[model samples]
Target: MLTPEEWAIVALSLRVSGVAMAVTLPVAFGLAYLLSRGRFPGRSLVDAVVHLPLVLPPVVTGWLLLLAFGRNGPVGGWLEAAFGVSVIFRWTGAAIAAGIMALPLMVRAIRLSIDAVDRRLEGAARTLGAGPWRTFATITLPLCLPGVLAGLVLGFARSIGEFGATITFVSNIPGETRTLPIAIYSALQIPGNDDAVWRLAGLSVALSLAALVVSEWLARRGQDDRAGHVL
Candidate 1:
């Protein structure tokens, strides 16, 4: 039985992870499409930049985010001054941190999916008088859906599990930025809190498995959809 506080932690984590997924999906999809299909200048550079967060230490990435989005940081300052919106040490900050941390996984999954798409199908659609956008929507997009599903699920899982970047960027404030991992850590720091830790760990495991199961289902459904389309 999760205490109210524990439930709150779970709720906050879900909110943050959901926001992270929603915000990153379009951007990740765009990047995946560009890297997989479009040939342009600085392509390699863009790829490296997109995957930099994956290679960098979580702390380093978080620190960079802080420097770029902190209250006094340039972008953060401008947002606050213009729209009066603040992300520093706020729930939005957690979302941003989670988004950046999960982006590489999302982009990688989506990119691979896009890469696996058969260009012949796209070409055939174009030959049938389909424009670029029309062909992509009818052929390429549908074919790459499994990968998109995989990326979205992976991103959601990563966001839920994110600790280092989120904590560093937003600090663990109760009912605000304290997610499951943060809650578990807090329990460990307290004496005779092993039960709480175990429960939280169990929840994490369950959440991960749920995400994977959902992803698998979607991937299979996508395969069926594509098969029916082929028929």
Candidate 2:
């Protein structure tokens, strides 16, 4: 049984991870589609930028985010002036950090699925009088749904475990920016908090494992479905 405080932490973590997924999903899909199908100028550059966070140290990513989205940063300053909204040291900022960290994973998974789709099927649909948007909605998206779902699960898991970037972006303010990973770190810093640390750590591991298992299962199912479609 978790203490009330621990439960609150868990709930906040879920909310942040869920919001991050919601915010990232459409952008991830759009990038995946563009990368898989479009041949625009700077395509490689865009792809590299999309995956930059994956290669950069999390702290570096966080630092860049702070520089870009902090109140004094250009984008952040404009947003504040225009909308009167601020994310600094808030849960929203933490969600942004988590979403960014998870974006590459989501985009890569969805792009792989999109690439596996047969072009001929799309062409056939177009020939049968379907417009591009209709063909994609009816043929392409359905075939790649499993991968999208898998990506969502994988991204959510990544968001749940996000630490370095989140801490850097939002700091570990309880009831706000402190998520599972941050909570674990906080527990570790306190003397004689071994029991709390163990409990939180165990919960985090279990959640991550479950998400990974589901993601793997979804990916395999997608592959099997594609194989059957081919046969």
Predicted model with the maximum lDDT: 2
Off by over 4 Å in 1: 216-231
Clashing pairs in 1: none
lDDT of each: 0.90, 0.95
* Residue lDDT tens for model 2, 162-199: 99999988998999999999999999999999999999
Instruction: Return the TM-score for candidate 1, rounded to 2 decimals.
Output: 0.93
lDDT for each residue of candidate 1 in 148-183, tens digit (9 for 90 to 100): 998899889989999998888889899999999989
Output the worst ten-in-a-row residue range by lDDT, candidate 2: 222-231
TM-score of each: 0.93, 0.98
Clash count per candidate = 0, 0
Consecutive 10-residue window with the lowest summed lDDT within model 1: 222-231
